[model samples]
Target: MTDEQIREYFEKVDKNINESGYHLTNVFATAETPSFCYSTGIFKSFNIPEIFISSLPPGLCSEIIENYVEAFKESKEAKRNQRLDFLTERFPVYLIDVPVPSLKEYVLSSIKIYGDEEYKYLQVIYPDTKGNFPNDAGYDYDQEIMGEFNN
Candidate 1:
């Protein structure tokens, strides 16, 4: 997408969030090019994901979380397990208490493999496993990563 289109896309997203009175600053994923990415935010406290479904614009919450919803839906275990009933209902809750590396790998791999030009301007929506990120190094590294995708 051209720079103007990208700018317009973000403007719309900002307008939506701004109307809600709570803006999420740190949630988004990049697909392929650095020129644009899917951006959205989730509220988490103490590493637990929270969803105020009513606060999200109509259908926007589902669009942002379709990936995780589908993954759980397709899982046989997730279906049979009574414990996962809440997830099956599509409530916004954090299910992964374990923070395994494979889970992280799966998420990152999914984005890398599926991201494409058609999704260049899609607005969308991770937490760190490690305890408090280092002050200087973590901030610098995050800036570096953001820079890589902000071009």
Candidate 2:
């Protein structure tokens, strides 16, 4: 989809969530575990840092993974540059990151796109953060990794 289409899609989703009174991030939720993430860089174009890392041509995931793992833990300004460096090494036919709302939806979308009659390879990794939401999410941010910050 073009950038305009993407924007429209997001706007629709945003409106639905607002009317439903759900968290903006919860746009991905549907029943079961709503906290899963999917790698769609192989399918279509989307934007995010991960899109670049996951969509490499071939034999590049290993190198990308090594560099990306480091990026997550690094603090230097150079880390972002390194992230971009490893990502552009192999451009998937498409983009970098695509966020789906749930595990089932993510899987179904992939199957529809990549199955024999139907499943393509989509890798999903769900990260769990063991912290409660701040009393005021409207504050714009939260604690980092550990400790307790009120944002």
Q: State the C-alpha lDDT per candidate.
A: 0.29, 0.30
Model 1: lDDT to the true structure: 0.29
- Which portions of model 2 show Cα errors greater than 4 Å? 1-27, 41-105, 117-151
* lDDT for model 2: 0.30
In candidate 1, clashing pairs total 2
Which tens-of-lDDT digit does each residue in 1-151 have in candidate 1?
A: 7989867756765564456421232224355322212223221111112221212333444444444334433442222111232332433222222222212322332233224411111111111233222232332212112111110
Among all windows of 10 consecutive residues in model 2, the one with the lowest summed lDDT is 118-127
- Going through the candidates in the order shown, the clash numbers are 2, 6
What RMSD does model 2 have?
15.8
